[model samples]
Target: MVRRLPFLLGGIALFLVNALTLSIGFGFGLSGVPAALLIAAPVVLCWYRPMAAWWLALAGLLLLTLLGPVLSDDEALQYRPWLLNAIPAHLAVVYVLALSVRLRIAIPAFVIYLAAGALTPIHLLDDLPNAIAGAIVWAMAVLVAMVLGHNKRVRLTSTLRIAEERGRRLVLEERNRIARELHDMVAHHMSVIAVQTATARYRLPGGVSEEASREFQAINATARESLREMRHLLGVLRDPADPAETEPPPQGLADLPRLMESARRAGTPVRLAVVDTPDPLSPAAALTAYRIVQEALSNVVRHATGAATRVEVAPDETCSALIVEVHNAPPDAPPPAVERPHPGHGLVGMRERVAVHGGDMTAAPTPEGGFIVRATLPLASSTGAGEPSPDVMDGGDGRDTSDDQRIDRR
Candidate 1:
């Protein structure tokens, strides 16, 4: 409705002005008022009822052409040619029809207008050149209106296509993320069960009874069955159309040491610390914590090369949640600002991960010219089990003891 406002206002103004001009020129008598109303009807009706407007315009043109001599004195008739008087209403009807109806309907109306002009008696058959010129000009105005309507339809179709493509892309990305989360949650528990069962079987004393050994074997079998069911469930959640694409399982806190080692090798000096004894984390919370640190380190590597970073993980005193923080100092010689990639998608991905687990995360610049990312993931009662599993680390302290490289910067 709002889109039609400009056309409505412009049409009313044009019709009123034309009607007043013609009435004043003809001395405002009974004949002049009726003729002026005939001229103005098409433009006014074009706004609400365009098809009716076209019919009214044709009737007005035919009336003026046939009775023009009787309605006006010779002086008034000589002042304006019949063709000139008909042009405004004729053009207004054609323009509105072209925009409001299909080409099949609008073209026939134009043909009817031409037939009416041919039947009129005012034009002398001997004046062939003038009649031909007038017909050509009227046809050209109708053609212009058709071209304008065609361009508008083309632009609207293109806009709708672009919007549809964007919506599909967003839905595909979200499905992929959900698949990743499911794989991470199920795979982590299965891995822990497998590793723990194998370790217990190997560490058993030589004098162990046959009954205890069979029980160990039974536990291992149960864990393997659970893992097989998990794989089938994950397959159902994945996109069936793209069977060739497979997503790897997501990493957790256990993978942090390897991630830090990779960053160190990439030339960023990193320090790791765990202030309190680490507790076993649920798969969702662990994945969220890992992703936050991963994205933060990735940003530092991409934007703040030659900088030093620190990663800290500690359990809350109440054992209700785990706090994780990744901090990176500004590079000794900062890179150009334009060299940094736009941070839109990466930050959005991090926020989505945190929101899924109902965690709070913040990334901000520090007072001493550095960047820090802090996250707190709420812990569930089922997450508190034994100590950190051996599959993630081999030592009691949650620190990587691999080769460390020290670099000195001025």
Candidate 2:
């Protein structure tokens, strides 16, 4: 309704002018109502079907020209080409015509309408000064309407193009980020494969044949070559300005105690619990879980300061997946602008991370007026195996908050 307000208002204004023209009758008896509808309906309909409404407006002009208004008032008879009260109504149709068509169509349409308007006067030279002056005024009206409409069309098209380009760029950047993360995860496993193959002869209980040893050497070389290709690919995905190669590796599940401790220091009361298992998470899953919790905690601190927050990580009922959840209670007293809502950029990134690993996640406001986010990442030996079991750190700010930590219960 809000979007249609301008059109609705314009329709009513034009309708009223046509209504006044009908009330005066001006020589056509009961037939003027059809002419009035032809002039007025176009104002409302032109938004959806400009060309059709333009034809209707033209028909109304033709009707007025054929049955010229026979009025006693000399001043009123002067605007016969427009039928006096219909000028505004007809001008609106021309404006919309400019908006609806290309420059070739709009420019030629304006010329045809202006020429027709000038030629349609019942008596062209009876009042020479008024005739010349009316032509200038009418030409200006038509010219301004088309110019404004054409510029408006160009401006709207540019804005739509800009939005589309921005969306495409954001999508490409996100794909690169996901690619870098996968490369880092796969590179770790490939390095392990190379190491294991290199040591097979020494580690195996039974002595291997010379042929078996050669096969092991071949596997090691292949793994190393694959790692090199991935590294080259990672370089391509990374930005030239990024110093990420020198930065410390990103934190994973093992870093959560420290994360919770920082949230605690930020004035959010927080607790964590980790259920240990013999099976370990793929580096990608651990990092993604760690990021989800980190972002959830950050949002709690920003939007619900002093909220009691809990972070939990454990296997689901069947033990085939890891379930990580973060829940925050409502704040006691939010800071200025803290409660103001924002677009959830953090949640979107977390969802993308989970999606890349074929996981499902949900983030929504809680009935308690806080927020909760839960992610389920599938697990299997083929997906993730040799990473060490996560152990709680004495949370660097170096105080051991044993009461707040989950002692890895195997």
Q: Flag regions of model 2 displaced more than 4 Å.
A: 1-3, 25-34, 70-84, 122-125, 243-281, 289-410
What would the TM-score be for candidate 2 when compared with the true structure? 0.69
CA displacement after TM-score superposition, residue 44 of candidate 2 (Å)? 2.0
* Cand. 2 Cα-lDDT: 0.70
lDDT of predicted model 1: 0.63
Which one wins on lDDT?
A: 2
Indicate the residue-level lDDT of 242 in model 2: 53
Spell out the clash pairs found in candidate 2: none
Off by over 4 Å in 1: 1-6, 26-70, 74-93, 116-129, 189-410
Q: Relative to the unseen true structure, what is the C-alpha lDDT of residue 195 in candidate 1, on a scale of 0 to 100? A: 68
TM-score of each: 0.45, 0.69
Report the lDDT tens digits of candidate 2 across residue range 72-134: 233444235544577777678788888768889998888877766765543555566776677
Clash number for each model: 0, 0
Per-residue lDDT for 60-137 in model 1, tens only? 777765665455554333212235554666666677777677778877887887677654434434555665666677
Q: Give the range where candidate 2 is weakest over 10 consecutive residues by summed lDDT.
A: 401-410
Per-residue lDDT, model 1, residue 386, is 38
